[model samples]
Target: MFELTRYDGRRRVRGSIALSVGLSALAAMVIWVYPSFEAEVDLDQLLAAYPDPILQVMGVQTMTSLGGFLSFELYTFGWVIMLGLYLAYSTAGTIADDVDRGRMDVLLSMPLSRRRLVAERFAAMAVPIVGANLLPPVVVFIGARLIDHPLAATDVLAVHLLSIPYLFACAGIGLLASVVFDRAAIAQRVALGVTFALFLSESLLTGTDAETVGSIAPMRYYDPNAVLLEGHYDLVGAGMLVAMTLAFLVASQLWFGRTDIH
Candidate 1:
């Protein structure tokens, strides 16, 4: 099952790997360094230098230093939203792509269970995800080194540690879509739209009285400010993320198991 599925997966894997690299680079620049430089300029002071209403609209006062970047600021929200988009883009069509290209039957005809086949294909998708999640910290590490700043290895790792489960959850969501939606384009659309909606719900919940909506968006639980800056992790939130990933993975397996690939 693994061999057959991946034989088809290997077809699309290279391009996705390239995309992961691109995502990592873009994330490092937009999410990591943009805030780093914005911090150096004392964006907080500048915001404070302005009036409350103005800063409220511009959304700069929340940041005081490189550390302040972790707050639910625009860039942080942007990063979460953008990464979700990438996750959807990368994982959504992975399985359905093969099927739409008329290859699901070719692979399933071999001595393999559809469940086992989808599982391996799902694992194959993670290689690029790991690369995407890990790459930013490496750049941040190098930047921290160059500036003689503190880069608590644990904290740096904590950010990625906090992030990867969400990635898998998204991947699982995509795979679930793959099994349910016959058209690759439709599957990709469902995953990307749903993930982005989650991102927006979480962001809005960060400021407004929308905690209820937040319960629906997993990213709301991450609290990058506390984890990335305060160096405190919400074990419960992280645990839930893990649980969600497992749930989605199992759901994917079950859905695929019952699916008629023909």
Candidate 2:
């Protein structure tokens, strides 16, 4: 029944592994450099020199501790921005690429309903999202311990767990774009552009008068600093992200079901 899901999920395994390893390597590098960085620079003074907007956008609450450093250097940029964008870019190609290459007609000729196809294809995105989230915490925790900056295991796990919904929400945006555009390249570009714009809006407009406009952005709900540095998991925000994912998924299914393939 879920043949499409299994096929797509299997296809993503190698890429997901490569992504996990690459992120682990980056985490190791960041952890390895912390001691030297701490010795060579005044974190407080350096952070103070940056404008408030820049700090807020980077999710840099502090840089004096290992958790804070990893939060700002690794999770904020690696997980929040890079991983989020990767998923959006990957998911953006799913349906659109199939359509662009005339594979959609072949798939539609099978027993699968449009909704099931969309749902299962979207479900396949979990392979990468979960893989990327699952391995990094172990690496981060071990790297921290090796560097004599042991982190709370629970906090590291919480950060990755919370990121799942955030990543799914990002993929949902790509899914919407995938259905809207027939060309994979065009859909991918649009999805990347929209996701990044949302990220910028959330980062730049938080305390400003236009903050309300940024509330719709999924990035606004996921705060790595809150999880890693403060040990505060935002369950409410995760729930909101899950809701946004479902909304985007439903919207995509509806639009795809009605649209003409040609």
Candidate 3:
């Protein structure tokens, strides 16, 4: 059996350095921009456009002020989901890489079972995906602290807690693609495409006054501003995200088990 967890840890540390760098820059920019204050445009009109049902579905508070912009970092659900998507893009290749290079065949010739190989490959992918998913928020949080404008730490932590499942969702998406496609590049495209669709759905749903549509996107359950900046918690919304992650992950694992890699 492949000692999957140990190999995963080493690769995760090496690959996720890029994730740390990218997110650090993003967090710095966000914090750097925090101080360049300007009056919000047409505050009254914008506030008037606030739709409650969508807000309920998206899990955010309506804000039309400078303060809200600081919290806007969190409200922008697309970015967080995108972060996970990027991690998936960076990862989705463990088994495919081996298979394409003839390494899997060599490894399979050993005592390791096919299922053991899959589990190890998945573990290798998961570690870095988790690290990449986590690094940005921490960098942002630290930047906020340095600037002395660290918004609600507890609330942001709460939001990140919610983000856990979202990251898993991305991983599951990639895993599903991995099983369905024999090629790594194709699986990557599938993962990224699906993630983009989710983001698009959230954008379209939030743009409309309709709560019905927004509820369909997993991203809709999290409003970064409310959870990470404003210190709001939505247990029900978080639950939905976790549930979706579970569904995707279980389905992907089963599919992977049935797949015959040649």
Tens digit per residue, CA lDDT, model 3, 4-48: 667766867866777656755765676766655324356556545
Model 3 segments beyond 4 Å from truth?
39-67, 70-79, 110-113, 133-142, 145-150, 206-216
Give the Cα error of residue 144 in candidate 1, in Å: 1.7
**TM-score: model 1 vs. ground truth:** 0.79
In the predicted model 3, the residue pairs found to clash are: 74-224, 74-225, 75-224, 75-225
The per-model lDDT (C-alpha) reads 0.66, 0.93, 0.63
lDDT-wise, the better of 1 and 2 is: 2
Each prediction's total of clashing residue pairs, residues at least 3 apart in sequence or on different chains, is: 0, 0, 4
Judging by TM-score against the true structure, name the best candidate: 2
What is the C-alpha lDDT profile of model 2 across 1-262, one tens digit per residue? 9999999999999999999989989998999999999999999999999999899888788999999998889988998899889999999999999999999999999998999999999999999999987777898999899989899999999999999999999999999999999999999999999999999899999888999999999988888788877789999999999999999999999999999998
Candidate 2 regions off by >4 Å?
A: none
Estimated TM-score per prediction?
0.79, 0.98, 0.75
For candidate 2, the TM-score is 0.98
- Candidate 1 lDDT, 118-237, residue by residue in tens: 778777766656656555666655655565555677776777667777777767777777777877999999998888777666655556676587676667656566665678977788
Sorted on TM-score, best first, the list reads 2, 1, 3
Question: How many angstroms is residue 187 displaced in model 2 relative to the true structure, after the best TM-score fit?
Answer: 0.2
Q: Clashing residue pairs, candidate 1?
A: none
**Which is the leading candidate under lDDT?**
2
